[model samples]
Target chain A: MGNEAFLAIGIFVFTYGFIIAEKIHRTIVAMIGGALMILFGIVSQHTAIEHIDFNTLGLLIGMMIIVSITAETGLFNFIAILAAKIVKGRPLALLIVFSLITAIGSSFLDNVTTVLLMVPVTFSIARQLKVTPIPFLTSEILMSNIGGTATMIGDPPNIMIGSSVKSLSFMDFISNLAPIIMVIIVVTVLLLLFIYRRQLHTTAEARARITDLDPGSEIVNRRLLIKSLLVLFLTITGFFLHQTLGIETATVALFGAFLLLLLTGENYLERALSKVEWTTIFFFVGLFVLVSGLVETGVITRFAQSVIDLTGGQLLPASFLILWMSAFASAFIDNIPFVATMIPVIQDMGNMGVRNLEPLWWSLALGACLGGNGMLIGASANLIVAGLSGKEGYPITFMKYMKIGLPVMILSIAISSAYIYLRYLL
Target chain B: MEKLFYMVNNELITLTEHRNENDFEFLIHTKTNEAADRLRKLREFFDSDRVYTDILFYARKDHEYQVIVRRDVYVPFVVHLLQLQLLKSVEWRTV
Candidate 1:
């Protein structure tokens, strides 16, 4: 390896090590690592800037703004309250219903944002029913990750993957991953129901309490709610026509966010902008430069060669290896950076005369996304949910989360394995 | 030790807490609104990682309602809630 490669690897290792240590904020770590790369001449400032995926960052920020505004209208709370009433406070039914809502919510909105909105409502219901919120919260986290896998806009990793590969469309993600995601979600819900069956019962009094709740009352601002819903509808429609409109997903989402802000009036502008997760945005900025260094140093090309060698140049073995590797690695590391680094490597593999790269992309997406459910620290969404629950004095311990999360993650990956085999391997 | 009270909606709302930063637990007495709804909505946001609420109990004593609620909120949010006085009480006690 060249001196530049050595320096790149050193910075990458140091940065991710700090991230995994959970001592320093990841954004700061990434930014420091990125700065080191530039200082060490691994990548120039211009090259590093070019490596940053504005599409991914823009899409994330835009959607975050929209979700921030929508959340203020109490739409998520209303949904939770309504779902509670619909299920009559039955714990098992609540789990199933909320999981369905989470999964679907994640399919379109970002999974982290969906979980953020849903966790409070879950806590409220659990408290009302006098039951532990762990089962419901865990199930929602798992379901949201699964649902986020179904659409290109669902997860940050998916957005990175989608934006990296121009030929891959939003519809392509939906068609390829949605069917298998449905199966995984259903199976996950059943597993949760089985695991929590004993604790999934509530008394008549609790059910009565939920029945008394008028979900309509939860909508604090009906005017803003209407406006938010309209813009959300248009944004989703724009996502569907992403290719037809010849516009990026980020542009569409930004348009929707701004339009909603405009119609809702300029009052929300400051709060909405402040609500954007800048740490997450900056983290992406640093990660892009770090990964770009790896690419520039030919590190990704060499890694792809090693993988090809390990698989003996066979497609099925290569596909399974990528899937499993992505799952395992993403279980511990942030899948966004992992996928960002891997995309270029995978493309390098394709450049090395690997035919049929589509399955590999699907495998990466499925493994990275579903793998997030393997542990509390696996995905950003899981961490957010865990943090929220922890603050509510219901901390989901690592062992507790892994006990359920690991098994479900393995099951989902197993199902995805079958789907990949049937859809592409055969 | 001190107790401060304010009357809103014809119900008394009281705040009693230790005068220590470490002590976030506060006692609230009110009858007009549900504690769960109040605390939950105050801490509500789309993607905050530093918000939590605990509404312990509600007991009615001859048309009076008293509930103990705890909140571990983001620093900024403390100000937001204090501004809105979601409880309709600018009066609080540092006991």
Candidate 2:
């Protein structure tokens, strides 16, 4: 490696280290690293800009807007209450229902947003039932990560993957990954149910109180809810047909977001825009440029070649390696940056004679997304739920979460390994 | 303890205090969303993780808001009510 390559490596390592250490805010660390790369002439300003994926950023902003406004309608709370009532407030049944709701919600919405909406309600329900909310909260965290693996727009990693690889469309993600996701969700929930079955017991009177709750009353604004639902449904439908229509997923998402804004009038414009996670968007900006330095310095290609040599240039071993590695790495570190860096590495693998790169991409997605279930700090959603729960006086300690999360993560990845080998390799 | 009435944001807010063995429950009845919004702001303040106040907010029908404030949180909750201009003055306690 030359001077530029060395510098790029140094900057990349520095950025990754700080991001993991997390003493400094990650966005600031990534932004500074990207700046250093440009300052050192590792990548030109134009080249750095070119590397930033607007599609991923746009899709994130669009979805954030939609979810932010939809949340104001109290729809999530209504759904949670409705689900609890449907199960007649049985704690075991409610646990399963809440997990399913969280998974399905994470499939369409982002995991943090899904949990943000669900945690308060989960606490309220648990309080009413006189049971601890740990099981419900942990199940939601795990299922959110798992369910997000099933859809292109579900998780940040998947969004990055879908945008980078044009061949993998919204429908493609659903068809390819949703099957395994369904199985994982069922198995994980069953395991969680068995573990928490004893604590789920409640008085008959408590059950009656839940049944008496009017779910409809949770809907704060009827008009806003109708408009939001309509737009959401149409947006999801647009995602399904975007590939067929020859449009980008970002375009579809942005269109849906603006349509909701227009329908709701300019009153919501400021509020919705304010709610967009600008910090996360900018973090993506910095990461793309930071990774671009490696891409420009030929580091990614070298890494890809090393992987090929290690795996004997075989697709099966390479795919399994990516899957398992991604799962464990994502469990401990931020998966978004991991996925961002891996996207180009996988692309380089494609160039280096990995005939079928499809399995590798799927493996990376499965590993990075599912790996988040391995520990409390594995995913953003986990931390958010934990923080919220801790504030509410029920703390989810790292070891406590890992006891359940680590095993579930390993089991899910094992299932994924089997699925990949049987479906594609065999 | 005592039932009190105050005018907040030009709307009447009726506060009825129910003393429990461990905490106090204050039933806040209002006729408009503005009062509820203000009360929500108070709830939000106490709900923050940084604050060590133990409070629970229950949104009931007919514009009724119930707040269960623990003994430890009562002082802070009352201070917030005064700060939000919902309590008029701290003298309401003595009254």
Candidate 3:
């Protein structure tokens, strides 16, 4: 009815259309939309700038820099070669280890980056093993997403939610959710087994083939390895040390990145940063303004509150909606921006006295991260893997991915939902 | 003018078209002949919406080739199939 309301709605429609069409880069669309929202008075420039959480941006940039430089040290290649070699190119064995590494890595670092670093080496390993990397890669991404869900600094969505909720602290998240995540991981592995049962057995003399492929002899950089390991350890420790030492997560991450830069310097670091996907970062900044407009106009609060009243505080419908719908929605749209937008909606639901909304947050995290396996564009990891691997002649098609990923995602998310319902809400 | 079909003994899945900036690595998990056949078909026509079309073939390469492989193993293969040529472009699958 009101002009501001109409403007907000218009912004939403435009953004949705641009995202779906995808002819335009998502970050560009978001940036333009954000700028226009301010120009149209949907949000004041000051308020829009205020809504931009530089802490999240700084963390994303800082870690990206560190990851970019560290990955160049051949550490990622080293790990991938080891994972593949340990399995001796066995698909089942490879799946378990790759997923474990991805999940564990994502829990500390950004999930997409974790996925990105692993993609190239994983490809090399699969080539060596003479089996499809699809299953192994899928498990890694799924695990990364689920594992990333446990930590506050793991993904952009978690970072946004963590910063928004005053009562929610890093310790609270790890303590409350980590136990449940363990159950989630087991269920995830079982789902992988169930989903890719046939692929597991396809391991024919791929062992010799793996040795033949060589991946340039899996060069071991012990000194670079030691340095990368040190920075990563300090960064992970900084997550827990934040409250007491008063060191910001961004500071630690950037510090690690700086250490990498100092060691690797610009020549090597540029190559790594090229892989960082600043477009996604801009996508974040843009969505912040677009979503902030609704918050500015009091629309997000109103919508979230109204939904809470309709649910009568029942956890079932809200939970179902959060888990299933979020997963399905993420299939079409990029999950990072989508999840970033939902942080406020979930937080508002909490404000409306929805008890146990933490499970709801977990649900969103599960759907957004795992559903990425369902389609190509669902997650940055999928895209990065595509970009890096595509150069080598293996092209992952949209339909082909869905054939494997759809069944896997459906079962995995369902298993996760059941796990959450039984462990927390039930 | 120039097109070729090479069997990959490697696990990497690739899709390329004759024209178009859209390119990608596809994930293929064909457990049976039929499954492999279908994946070959899909990768062949993946870029129908894009510029040019090509034929494809699916065969297990007996060994690493004189050729080069450039895709990521762990990435979901579909994300980059936008540029894969169809199997029709290839005359046949060799050993």
Ranking by DockQ: 2, 1, 3
Instruction: Give TM-scores for every candidate, taking all chains together and pairing residue i with residue i.
Output: 0.86, 0.91, 0.74
User: What is each predicted model's overall lDDT from 0 to 1?
Assistant: 0.82, 0.89, 0.66
Maximum-lDDT candidate: 2
Better of 1 and 3 by DockQ: 1
Candidates in order, interface RMSD in Å: 6.5, 4.5, 10.0
Considering summed lDDT, which 10 consecutive residues are worst modelled in model 3 chain B?
B49-58
Name the candidate, 2 or 3, with the larger DockQ value. 2
TM-score of 2: 0.91
Index of the highest-TM-score prediction: 2
* B14-95 per-residue lDDT for model 1 (tens digits): 5554333432434444444554355445444412444434432222232222222443432343444455454354455777
Query: What DockQ values do the models have?
Result: 0.15, 0.19, 0.03
Q: What is the TM-score of chain A, computed separately for every candidate? A: 0.98, 0.99, 0.87
| Per-residue lDDT of A173 in model 3 | 66
lDDT: which is higher, 2 or 3? 2
* Candidate 3 per-residue lDDT over residues A1-426, each given as its tens digit: 477977897987798689778898888899998998999988888999888877777778877776765664556655665666666766777788888888778877777678766765575566545567667766775677677767877766677666666556677668755766677678778877888888666446657554344333233346666777787777777867776776666676677777776775567666766767688778878888888998878778887876677676788778767778778877777776677677888878878788778778777767776676677777766666655555545676777667766776787678778867886777
Candidate 2's docking class is: incorrect
Q: Each candidate: how many clashes?
A: 0, 0, 44
